[model samples]
Target: MPITLTIPDGLLSPTAQAEAFAALTEAVLEVSGLNGNAFMTSNVVGSINVLPREHVLVAGKPAQAAFVELKLPEIALATPEAKRTFIEKATDVVERAAGGRLQRDHIWSNIVYAPDGAWGIAGRSYDNGDLISAITGSAA
Candidate 1:
């Protein structure tokens, strides 16, 4: 199944967006047992949001806040093990990116596993469905 991973705002620095994407691509490849070539071809999409004048009560005073959000299409891997492994690695990358600079409580995410038929195709005829089935099973 393709697993969609959603990363909430404030989990990473806007400047580090590229780095974060690279990290995710690397992590997914590592867990999926795929080479750098395969990882590079994977369809990866991301977005960032900046809230202006967001206020929060701090020590009985209002404070401004900012954050970023990321979304990854549930990439199909070679197996279920690979899927789980990728998720673990991805989570680690997210946590490391967040570090202690952002409030952990503000971080939000969701993983949605869908059937292979539901997986979207992107790029020039490059789809991970076959690879994902090889690892996760036909249902994926």
Candidate 2:
């Protein structure tokens, strides 16, 4: 899984940006119940893009906004409840990190599931079963 975070450069202090990234990672793993799974933990990766104010847009107008997008295989956050939990928690993590600098309404989050076998890491593609086996350290 990869969690991408995009925020206006000034929206968060350097310390907050680092805090948010770490919190966001934990939220994803915790919500998906993969917190301690080696494969899942190692694969949970992404970039934090701190764009210029003018480059950040909301409703076609430049604004202070943040977006957290998660791309993962089907089995990750597989349930509606799980996805909802992640959205709520992820948004909270970002907002809190901003130290009230960002409006809750300005934060957006979404989980996008890849088709089975379409997710990859280190040049190896993984399907639902492949992930399960790796996470559990067992043959499927």
Task: Point to the candidate with the largest TM-score.
Answer: 2
List CA RMSD, all candidates: 7.1, 1.8
User: For candidate 2, which ten residues in a row score worst on lDDT?
Assistant: 131-140
Per-model clash counts, in order, read: 11, 0
- Summarize candidate 2's per-residue lDDT along 1-140 as a digit string, tens digits: 78899999889888888899999999988987777777778888899999989999999999989999999888778888998999999999998988888899999998898999998889998888888888889322
Per-candidate Cα lDDT values, in order, are 0.46, 0.88
Please identify model 1 stretches exceeding 4 Å from their true place: 1-11, 38-40, 48-83, 103-109, 122-140
The superposed Cα distance between candidate 2 and the true structure at residue 126, in angstroms, equals 1.2
